[model samples]
Target: MLLPTRPCGPLLAAVLPCLASPLAAQSTDPGNSEPEPAGPTIVVTGALESRSLQSLDTPGLGLAVDADQIAAVNAINTEDVIRYAPGLVVRKRYIGDANATLSLRNMHTTQTPRALVSVDGFVIANFLGASFDTAPKWGVLAPGDIARAEIVYGPSSARYSGHALGGVLRLETEPVSRTAVSLGAQSFFQSYRYYETDEDLFGYALDARADLALGSGGISFAWRHFENEGQPQQWRTVAPGTPYAAQATIDDALGFPLRIAAQDSVVDAREDQFRLRANQELGGDWELRALAALLLDRDGTSEPKSFLTDGDGQPTFVGIAGVTLGRSRSAELLAGLGLKGHLGDWSLDLAVSRFETLDDRSRQSDPADLATGLIPQGGIVTDENARWTTIELTVERAIGPHRLALGASYAGYAGRSRTAPVSDWRTAAPGPVRNASGGKSELIGLFVEDAISLTPALEATLGLRYERWRAADGFLQNAGARVDYRGRTDAAWSPKVALAWRVSDTSELSASLAWATRFPTIGELYQASLIAYGPNVGEIDLGGFDPDLAPERGFDMQVTARQRLGTIDLTLSGYRQNVRDTLFGQTILVAGPGEVPVSQSLITNIGAVETWGVDFIVAAEDVVIEGLSFDGNISWIDARIEGNPLNPALEGNRFPRVPEWRANASLRYAVSDAFELAASVRHQSTPERNLENSASSRCDTFFCVSSFAFVDLKASVDFGPFALDLGVDNLLGERAFVFHPYPGRTFVAGLRWTGGRP
Candidate 1:
């Protein structure tokens, strides 16, 4: 849960030249050659995998960061690794937010399924749905467990599936090396002040890890515990039926005057993570790797506060539609196994994984129930069975001038949930089912790619991926009335091309183009949305899902240039992508005369959109001074809707949540090998609330995204067997919003001690 706030340098993170140069590898290290290795290992330095661990060899622009850099970041969650990266944003509401959403370029924050996120080659991004409720499982990772993180932008790699349309991210964990044991702890405090609310929030984490020497290899076990309290996620306004407050009223996001009522929730969370990994070299260059992880989440909102006062200056909560004062707990498990080695003339790779939620249940109670103190009251929602499984087989061989690679992948998902009125909210016996749903989704993919050496200066790659997708066992129940949905299947072909030119020893150029098809997620295909997220938090009734909705299909293209100037590295990249049949949530109205012109919200194929962007990255060591180094990048994107017949008024409007300009930079000075000082700055322009680029974008108000600039500083000191960390985020104490108010200014301090290895 630690990462540098600075942008990962172009050299460490993006647009790097191919590894080993495909042309050179084809001739020098063909899989056809056999190597003899009969060595016994006591400590597993690492596994010898046929495939390269670095994914930056992919056609598109990519970025990377290592453990040394991660240790410098003042972060509390794994997702914060990319918070300040170029063309990236982690919609993290607070220090311990479980719904931290990640946005890649044009994908925006709410489109969670568009990105392919993996850890140690195991898929962690949730394809269950594209929203906060189904965010990637970052909490499953033990804090301080990652060694490196890399990301490839766009869907130009045939080795990956359409989820790469947004981007592909991979987190590499530390390999078990020698027998070692370590323990670490960190604590953080944030001072926050906003409209009608002010307070201080604090959190901390404890981590322990052990690496043991096993028979012929090594195994590692890690555990982490975290607890935190966050500010209220939202504030209510504009409700009738009563109590007037003493505080002054304020204008809302749309300039509407209203009194701030009770807050949504001030979350209190406790989480625990346990993970185990084992690696063994099976002789003959073959290796086996295995992983098992578990995560438990306990969150609740026990205190409900209402700003409004009754007739005698007493607090009242009668006007609110819902006031939750209950807790939710869930347990999740993830397991993976992989094998890679030589198979005759080809190098073969196999991977399999399963992620499941063993128990997921929530208890919610209306505030009125607290007054009555009934023995049995409130409601219980259960999602007892939800899981995903993935399997992959890949092989590669160098034949003549072509390096041929082929792979097949399968991913399956299933989920079921029920909501019922209970006797007791905490340990309830269900009375009658109020709402329920069950469904399944799956994808089967086959891909082939060939890297050819056109000449010494030129290299080309051609690739294609074919996918078959299906959805079944869909059902929705309301008040015991069940409705079943028909099953559906789809097939699509994605094609990709990439070219790289070694201009000279000082420079290089590359370009890539691809076509990808992204199918609908399970929730988007079956569930009817009741509460809206983002800026449009007002009450809405989205009636039903379109089971036959068209899949998102698009063309992505990019060009890049890189140059080395002494100790400095510079990279410029540009990209353009257009997605048709874009699956979006919007409103349409078609009321007849004499009927009320009410907008009907729907999640459907919302026509088409085109996006264009440019990024400039600069990384330099020993700038003007010997100890000074800098890493920075700037991005500009213009994403707009092309047309939408159903909501034509939105034509030519900016895409929601995509900022027009954003930049990240970090400067560091090493006083010595044991001491370092670093400073980082993050900035982003205000974004639109909806597809129409609504005029109601309030920059510094509740429920709105605002242009923000934050400065952070960190100082670290290392002793032989111990380390000390001191950092402050948002040094300027600037105010901003990402639907929920962003943290004001936070101070962090940590201490770690290690001793077993030396």
Candidate 2:
């Protein structure tokens, strides 16, 4: 599974040709071909320039946000491009957050691997592992470089891999149209307040990009520098004898006062990212694309502050947390190459990509006295390496009312992590591994899809996909003991069907049903943590990982109705998803002959979940005025665990972080030729943090999601090639939480210059 680096042409050539045998007729677009004598025309909304989305033929077509729409929002990072897209949300805690996770519908953020994110048809989402630490590589993109962003709903098309359970996020960069350079700068700040803490967190971003218009193609290079200081992500429960004054403490989810302590994830971070892309046309309706990106980050987590004082009323609180806390450095790389050709009535696409974690070293040291901080002591450094590669091929052709497509793809992952102690965490090196866990995974897929115009105003499409997945080269080590597990494989087939009808000139109704499977990642398969029982005590040893953990299987269905009325559009959608064999692992005491029992994690397939939701949207342009527009949406979702034999307490509890209600509204108006004003409002209901939905659900502390609403306002002024903007988020100072406190009353300002010679 450890395939060669990116641009692996020979490997791609050897693998992608599997679909060549079915090279026949399908068109990627319905607008490109003219309708027949009395055929009904189906107008798709938000279809971008080139149909890069494989699920275009599926019902409940995706939503799109263009440069103009993006300009109306106050975005902090690249993922913010789709922040307000219908049914989509990014768990971005603050500015410059690298671990921002994207959630879809009723799917919680914990299912990170189920969401597939791509840029220019190449996979950029981190598949090495499935957690917030392995979130999508959004840092590789600069916000100013994006031209359009779209989100396709569900895994209803054969054009996608199994990772498309939640959905797909697609982004495209601006085409290099001129030899020009652009510079952008933005600054933001927030007033944050919580128990025992009240302060301001701030950040800034700077970016520059240059594009070259080649004779027959184009090339572009971009660089971004960001620095930010965020509020503490965690706090220590304040009890008697803690560093802080217990009497002055405040309550949290766990029902206790809390104080900032060492290793609180109070991050002060800086990042530098660079990217280059080139696109060239090769006559005969063929084009080639290449992309390269690099990201570097240095994070500092300093000692926490204390409010305790001595007899003299001077600061005196000084203590050490039980965990190591210090600095970390990381670097990653992404590279991709793709070729597309238009062969008369058919189209062919081939691409290869690799996302590699080149170097990641985390150093942690024991905290010293606050006055004489950071004494050198025996510390630990965790080193990690990971990467994944993808190669894909697709052929599409259309003949009369029948359109068909065939696709083949291969994806592989390789990752390793080890931790050992060093003499000095700051600089010293050389140590033997005390613990380690690693493995490899691979998936190969082939699929076929056919869509036919069943009647004058009705269409039907059927798609089926076959996938083979395997994991090998897995090992977990503890102390001097080691265990190796390998050669585990599984296969599954996903089928999809969709029907759409154009009821009238201004209305359309559609329904879709799909079955999808999500395979366990290398991390999930390895289990990765080992515990031991003493042999001298006459106790048998229990293995660390459960190699037989089954894959997660799910069925998804949706129905949608869209109607256009005068200058307004109304849409209503309903969806349901059921999943089995959910990966819910737990550890408990196992009886042994000796006095001490053993506790080890058992990775098992032990749960079933069900989710259902409905959403309504309203949009309009020129509402009573020539330059006024409004867009609003509201949704309700229900997600709960159906059965859990091992933990029956959760048999009917709500899923973690799945809110029941959500809504968003935006209004834009043109004040003058050079000025525009836009405002937005967003809201969500409280989300439970625990599987059983018990004690933590009623609190709005560290482990809670608050039911809150906030407003945002932005004003932009443009003059020739220069633009200036000012905006405010949480305009009403709304207080909320999603584990970490959401920023409050934040103000943002930016300036950009685009019309300049390179």
Write model 2 residue lDDT over 1-758, tens digit each, in one string.
Answer: 01112221232233322211110011234523322323233333322222223234444456666676678888878987776676767787777778888888876775778888988878987776666677888987887767888777778676777788888788887656578888999999887776656667889999888889887788999898998887767655333564444434555446654444332545787899999988988887788998899999988776555445555665433443333457888999999999988777777889899998888998987545444333457787899998989998988877787777889999999999888878888888938887788889999999998778888878887899999999999888765777888588899999989887766545556788999988988767775544355553322132545766788888989876655555565556788988888765555455545656666555566578898998776666678898887777788989999977766767788887788888988888988878999999888888877676877565665657777788999999999998999999889988777777777788999999986553
In order, candidate lDDTs are: 0.75, 0.73
lDDT for model 1, on a 0 to 1 scale?
Answer: 0.75
Q: Output the number of the lDDT-best candidate.
A: 1
Model 2 RMSD, rounded to 1 decimal? 9.2
lDDT for model 2 comes to 0.73
**How do the residues 1-758 of candidate 1 rate in per-residue lDDT, one tens digit apiece?**
01112333344234554321110011112432432111110000000111112422366677665454565678778887665567888888888888887788887787887889988778888888777777888976764777777777889888888888888888877666578888899999886766666667889999998888665568988898999888877776525444353353565556766567667667898999998998887888787888889999999877666666666777666554456668889999999998988888888889899999988888876445333222225656555578999998888877766777899999999988887777667776776887777789999999998777677656787999999999999887776467788899999999999887655444456789999999998877876644343344432223445777899998999987755545565667899999998888887774523575646566778788899999877666678888787767789999999978887888898989899998998888888999999899999999987776766764567778888899988999999889899999899998888878888888989888876752
Stretches of model 1 off by over 4 angstroms after superposition: 1-57, 238-241, 245-248, 367-377, 529-543, 590-597
Provide TM-scores for the models.
0.89, 0.89
